[model samples]
Target: MADFVEKASEKITKLSDEQLERLLNTVREENKIYDSIIQSIPSGLVIVDNNWCITKINKSAKRYLHFFHLHLIKSDPVWNLIADEEVSNFISFCAQKQNTNTNEEFSIVSADDKARFIVVSILPLVCDGKIAGTIIFIEDITAKRQQEILMHRMESLKSLTNLAASVAHEIKNPLGAISIHIQLLQKSIKKCREGDGQLPDEKFMEKYLSVVNEEIENLNKIVMDFLFAVRPLKVNMTLSEPDSIIEKSINFFMPEFENCGIEVSVNLQGNRNRLLIDEKLFREIFINIVQNAKAAILSSKKSNGKLAINSFIKNDHYILTIADNGCGMDEATCSRIFEPYYTTKADGTGLGLTTVYKIVKEFRGEITVNSELDEGTVFTVQIPVPQKETMLLEE
Candidate 1:
């Protein structure tokens, strides 16, 4: 807090010498009042001199920036606290800008997984028509960003629900015919080889058949996964071992992880594995998250990859968190991750995470994601446990 005070209001008439001296003494005693008001303001306030030195900073500014005022003062450049060059350039422009107040919204990720969106309005103070200093007002908008993400998810769920039946009717219904046709073609090829009794370029025929078979199988799997994603929730919720479910899901992707040189660790400590959850639905959720982690690692082009899974009981909920050392995402990608048909992968259908979100919601669970680009990603899930007495009473 600074001892600076704004100019006295001009409500007084022409006063005698004694009256003027009394008013001056009163103002001197109220200097701390201005400091208190500045410190109590919710928005961050920073005042910089013409030389770009941080002359006055309020408490909110220090808290928002996650820095101490002491570290930034003492003739240190103001822009050094902000890592981005673009932000620094804007600050410089704001300080020198004359006769105008500039407003801008930018995001800053601190030393944590969360990103802070801040709106800055820089007002230049002019002294005798010359640029003197700047007053930067900062407001945090992180909650606004989170609200936008929630709205996007609601819209995505509506779209997915409306399209699910039509897609299944148009494509999935013909899958049986497609599979039968592929089998017929295979039999026809076999007969041709048998009739000739002298197969030429047999390796060529085999390779072509292999590629076609693999693609058809891949297509069939994609359709099934999509249908599963759009399927109505009819899970059989019962007492189940959570660790077993985790292990089973990991087993499904074990070969792929090993092939990619990815090491995975699972910690089920304090996780009693006693929960009322649908085993199949749990498997589906784990598969989607684990596979995406693998895809992220592959995209990073790093020498090695790591996947860590930790589960524990917190309060009345079972919490699970998965961390990966892989190609992380920016704020935009992270926000839209749970939306249907929004994917970072070139070959991804983007319904995978959407399905996971749907299942989690059905189970009355909460899920969150944190990522840093080029660093990694982490997903935390907390599923509430129902009381045994309440269930028995219903019966």
Candidate 2:
């Protein structure tokens, strides 16, 4: 009885009623504010004690669990919620590591059963120089991953282009020499056969030589195309008028349109926006898009397919729209059209639009397209206005 009374007296002496009440109220308010902020954030946050026991979860984390068909409960194992074994292993490894928490990437299946990419960061919450708990922050990165893939594709195309240029340069000299020898041999054979009235199987020999010559020509054309695709030409910087550039591109492709029985229309209505563009590259971009449109229109089953090139200045930006009333592309194709070596046209190198995309990006411009199957296709290119001034040549 004496020992129990003594313990009670010590407890009462250590704590003041007002101090205990104030501390409790202050802690409750702080917890409420922390919870409010965590729930407000879009990123999923999970708080766990040192034992890896989930103590607090935000609404976003609950939503993520519902999406992934996982039930979140008190003391739920974080590893059980994670779908990827590698991620689970990583989490365990991080938990074991006393210092230097790491960020890990994981793919989780949502309730819709779609794989969603997320970057998870584990941060240790230290109290009195000892880890008290950990905070796990999950950031949805699906769009970022898609962009990364696109950038990777671009890198691959760049490397391929460089390799193609190297190979073309190496083959050109040998190919030229072989072509010269072939021409000389053909000439010598013709001369000898002409001298000998009875040509020794000249017909068969001529046919054989013709076939060889045709094959060589085809190889040469491929080489030329590769070289053209890979060669990086110096840009001739000039203050170019958008209207003249359009006019020149149209003029350049007029003959092709006539030959293909396709009608070409140009609507240049925008204020003459002066831009610093490499004339040659700009022409190539315009020509490629126009040529593609012409071909598409020509091949369309419709008797009269139309191609239109419209350029206008809008809000300090030069907006150019190229539309073709031809068999248009589906959504899948439009998404991949800018991709290198992706094309629907037969005998297409698949580099035309890619080249256009590259040039537009270099100029800090943007290009986008809209197309519906059998309806038509429209591509919009917005070129920003340059602050620098230069002399503009009139056509």
Candidate 3:
């Protein structure tokens, strides 16, 4: 006891009380700053101790792990807590090779059959020339991957541009001629009625012209879809309110809803909503989703079809729910619902929902669909708002 006291006194006697207090305060401030930086990172971080047990996890880390806020301590193994077999294996392998740090991408699939693409980097934490622990940093690369795919698709389309022009010209030229001929026939029929007391086949002419025009319109839409699929999508983000955007979209489609004998409803849900999104792209998102609902309703031929849009805030995202009482899809169809050129309609361009899915993902958001055959369909859109949920911690 005397030796310990002598050593402690020798270490501290050189510094006055004021200097010791100042040193203690500086250490505390440094620790606070460190914790702030660790939690502020967008990537998920998991810290595992030398015993291969979880020591700490950040808000983002919990999200990627599909594990919400839980007070985990050093005694809990990271692999045991996080139930992904692949993730567990990776962590175990890194623990075995404690001296080596590694970075790898992992594809994690959840119970809902939804796939998440993430990149995991396992870095060994060094302390006093030995491995103290391992730090796992996870980042969502889905948006980056989506952009690469879009760029590839665009590149492929460039090779087909000449053929696109050729096909468009050939298709439109005949349609143009047919339109002109139909107009002339209509005029001729009028003249015949005036020149002689002869009745013309008004019903037959009208029916034939209607069919021709409808077919012409369908062809034009397909051509346009091809052109648009290749066109570069320019996204400019702005701070905007979701309810305002939804209102504008509802106004534009009110006439269609009424004409189609569908009832439309919109609930802003208290209206304190804001998200960082591309205004033009978000408006287009609304238009596509609402139109899809209309199509589903019309196809189902439901006498009491109703469309409802409700907006609210959840977590750190602005949630928009667009639901319809119409023809819904089965599991098989839902699997590839976001794929390009996947459509349920006979005359659909198949790009409407695909466009919506792409834009939502581009803005770091997600689209989820719930439906059953012949019942109804609901689309839930979650767009992240870059706002801190808490001052000291984020989730």
Candidate 4:
């Protein structure tokens, strides 16, 4: 290739003035076309030398630079144009590792003091098997990022609306029952006053009162559950043993488990290291899940129902799993198990799993369920190990 270039150079020098002029004109036209292509690109393009000096920039890049209150000057350090220290540092790090391809997204405040999101991609410019510089592609993704955020908020608003509707529906049923019972009681008393001037029969009065009382209790429970599901939890982070909490929660329900003929098996061999969590909320997590499992077992009507709990550590996270050999849920049910006011049981408030989900998320953890109809279900919870403990374990 070197010899060929040398021959070509000699031929170029040997050309007559007229022919050379024609050749130069053609070369200049081709250069103009290349420049036009670069300028026409929508995304910002910048070329920087090995010294981090801006060598060439398209019109789009210049416009972006202007936003940053920078000018397109020859041999200007590219870092000087970046207002974000983190972004500048990242670019420098990437440039140091030649031949590296990097794509990064970050937010910057332009000269107008308006926040903008920018995506940057850097590619190595190679010459003679060595990196001579880098080609940077910058894209202003402020509009796109804002659109995504707006869409997410809209989705959240839609979910909130659905939740409100469910709450109203739940309250309406019990409220309607209470109202009917009250009206009946009023009529009975009015008839007694107008006819015999005597009180209503004890049994009839008791029946109506009991119905009203039960309906009121149901309404209270629904309100409480709704509040618990929506209220921001007050988390008190503590380093506590998960096994102990699990044992306590299970023991609290031992009588019910025995009466329902559901066998409970537990294996707590996970991280011996205490987890950083809220003790009350963490216990609630176990209680809710165990209650859910017990209900599933009862629903299955299994003669030899079994509830199994296990714990282990993997990938710097503590994993707690509960499996029940009970009537399982279908895919649709499983998918919405964590949604507010979603339940399969007649008496279920539908907020048990929702509360569990919120608690797990408070700990920066994750929960997942897998089940098949007529089979069984498994709920897996993963809580990240505390940073200090993880570091100690690694050591």
lDDT by residue (tens digit), candidate 4, 1-395:
34543455579968889867866676677778889999999888988888878877888765554424346445456776766675676677776665356566555565456666666777777789988888888787767655654563354454556777888999999989989999999999999999989999899899999999999998888787677766767765545678888887877888988988888898997445566578899988998888888888888898999999999988988999999988999999899999767788888877789889988876778899999898899999999765420111110
Stretches of candidate 3 exceeding 4 Å from the true structure: 1-232, 388-395
The 10 consecutive residues of candidate 4 with the worst lDDT sum are 386-395
The C-alpha RMSD in Å for every predicted model, in order, reads 21.3, 20.5, 15.9, 13.1
Arrange candidates, best TM-score first: 4, 3, 1, 2
User: Which of 1 and 2 is the better model by lDDT?
Assistant: 1
- Expressed as tens digits, the lDDT of each residue in 217-324 for candidate 3 is 767766775666555578655446677877877888799799989998888866545565678899999998888899999999999999989887778788899999
Q: List the residue pairs that clash in candidate 2.
A: 67-110, 67-111, 270-313
Cα displacement (angstroms), candidate 3, residue 344, comes to: 1.8
* Model 2, residue 159: C-alpha shift (Å): 13
lDDT of 2 by residue, 305-385 (tens): 788888877777888899999888898999999865678988997878988987876555789999988888898999876
* TM-scores of the candidates in the order shown: 0.42, 0.41, 0.43, 0.46
Candidate 2 accuracy as TM-score: 0.41
Q: Which stretches of candidate 2 lie over 4 Å from their true place?
A: 1-233, 388-395
Pick out the ten consecutive residues of candidate 2 with the lowest summed lDDT.
Answer: 386-395
TM-score winner:
4
Candidate 1: pairs in clash: none
Error of 2 at 117 (Å): 46
